[model samples]
Target chain A: MKVKAFLLGVLALAGVFVGFDLQNSHGTSFAAKKAANYDESVTLPMAKYPETGKHIKDAIAAGHSAVCTIDRGGAADRRKESLKGYPTKPGYDRDEFPMAMCKEGGKGADIRYITPADNRGAGSYIGNHVENYPDGTKVLISVK
Target chain B: MNKLLISYSQLIITNTDEEHSSFQWSDEDVKRGYSVQRGAVAIEAINNDESEIEVIVGSYLPSEKATVTYSLPFPVRADSIIVTSPGAVTLPFSVPKGTYQLHVEAIPLQQPTDDGLFPVRYQLYFDTNGSK
Candidate 1:
């Protein structure tokens, strides 16, 4: 009877360890799955050329798309702040890519146009950034 | 014979539309303190020429698909032996928040001789907040 009890206790410990490993593996797989489908939603407004904003408009009409349009208030600020600490994965540089956060009060929503080449895992990065935001915090992302 | 030369040019960014408080581009600024709060950028150009020179300013965000470009015609007078501008021509533009590489091409519209192109690359950091 003593021997059986000891073996049962050891088996229980092993089962706990297996459960923890499975949980960890599930978390990693979830992140990878999210990374694979990074496109969230189109938010960037139509891009306007300095001289002629027509090209961008026409392109939009023809199906050219903008990725994300973020609000310029506290929500936008939080998003920007979160992105600041976002770790640069392998083969990525924060400087090489242009990332503007416009704060013009009355000038509509701030738009960020990102191409596939520019945003390899932009969705995942953004998802990771907003992971800690309180419920109802708007986190918008779009891909082309 | 006159050579169109760009002696010195610096990219300045300001938070206010008034352009009173501005910061100059520095290596440290690019690495650590690069960010724009109000989305205003000023390109100060100094031309070394005896006469007026026409320059084209072209810029684009490396991560963005669209490019913003415009041209400027600068006038400079020559005095004594050295050619200098009466004052620096300030080109101001309202830019959205983002990291960008500004390329300025100063080509003499009137090139009697072969005065090679003077181009300068300035790294731009524009942020509404200090996120960049």
Candidate 2:
């Protein structure tokens, strides 16, 4: 209605997107800031860090797609399951494709040995970014 | 400060010594573009942004300057040219069979755009002309 529009205009004038409360399927209200800034999907730059990049490609090719799923919780459990059989090496870290945080990850995920610099750095870069996104999100796994 | 880069692709190049020989990978010659009627396999790899790339000739350990580097121990037969990037540009070059290291330098040469894809430029260090 025109009245609602006027109220929104007044709120926006006072502060950007203020008082913009919207309900979701769960019946919880979301702040206007979050409502306006939701990332539908994320892209994991496989080639951004080529060492970890190659491992991701090879792991997917080896049959692990959950690597594309974002983890909502239980990352420690997933890591334990996916890395159970792969022992750590002196110069290498056991890298899992469907990383621990991904919903599709854990237990039976493809594991590869890669350098720590590659494994840790790329993981943190993406982990830091996606931590802002909610759990159970599907991310686009891409190379180059 | 650390530099910002977009992509780091692991490229594979295959080379068959001859018609009836097993493939032994490594080194080669050429600078740009791909030849349809070619002797070596036309190879491709992924890069995120169309920033600038640095192609070096010779078999050396990976360089620290490169944003990302990998080894392609497959056979390569580039007696002519190569196609790189997101099909933006082509260059001519050549390499044969042997384990070789490839370095990808993805420094932004221009301002990035909204949608993320962009054009690319390159710099070549040394020549692998008749390089093995």
Candidate 3:
């Protein structure tokens, strides 16, 4: 009798966990219908480059909405338009959000100058995650 | 009786920054979805980490259960909308092709989640006869 009771208790406990897992997965409408696929999270290295972080935080603070779409078309033209009169400093690179590759990027986009290492590092990290994502793919920039 | 097309208990949203504050439907996408008619909705003050966005299609408009409401002038173009900030995703809802009158409601939950997540109920109703 003791052995049978113990087995039933364990089975009940296992069932509870399985139920919780299913409920969690189906909590979202997308998951309930079809597994939603997304590649929108991008991490920012704030500690590695405080200045770089400050520039982005400030731009976001000043009402420059982060445009999440990636266009990759007319990037050179957009970059040229935004950098027409911008000053470049020694040992620094000008970084902009709504990057020249984004459909939202162009003249008047947010621009910040930071070290080449920090600038390139950030760019590479973002590209690794979203390089192949289609245009208009929403992106979430996490300033960590 | 208004039929419930989609119901979501929790809608996740990533409040990336203050500037990216609203979740807007794509009018252009709507145009593509419908053969002759389409619609879209944009909800403001949606800084909440997550909120419930619910809509009804091909039925009568439901009762007023929102603090405020708005109707878009020109339709938006989008089969869906996506938002990603810290830990938010789109409340994925796909509607069948037809003309729609986009109605939205923003109900600020009296009690926000521990993470300060705001929940907004987006009720979009679609039926026939919405002019192009």
Predicted complexes: DockQ each: 0.02, 0.01, 0.01
Query: In order of the candidates, what TM-score does chain B achieve?
Result: 0.27, 0.37, 0.46
- Model 3 spans > 4 angstroms off: A1-39, B1-132
Please report, as a residue range, the 10-residue window in candidate 1 chain B with the lowest summed lDDT.
B77-86
lDDT of model 2 at position A60: 70
Q: What CAPRI class is candidate 1?
A: incorrect
Q: Model 1 off-target regions past 4 Å?
A: A1-144, B1-8, B11-16, B28-37, B42-132
Give the per-residue lDDT of model 2 (tens digit) for B19-56.
22111212221112111122333222222233344445
Which candidate number would show the highest lDDT if scored against the true structure?
3
TM per candidate: 0.18, 0.37, 0.39
Evaluation by TM-score, superior candidate among 1 and 2: 2
DockQ, model 2, C-alpha based: 0.01
**All candidates: CA RMSD in angstroms?**
20.0, 16.1, 18.6
- What's the CA error at residue A135 for candidate 1, in Å? 58
- Model 1, position A30, has a per-residue lDDT of 50
Q: A24 in model 3: Cα distance from truth in Å?
A: 6.1
The lDDT for every candidate, in the order shown, is 0.30, 0.43, 0.47
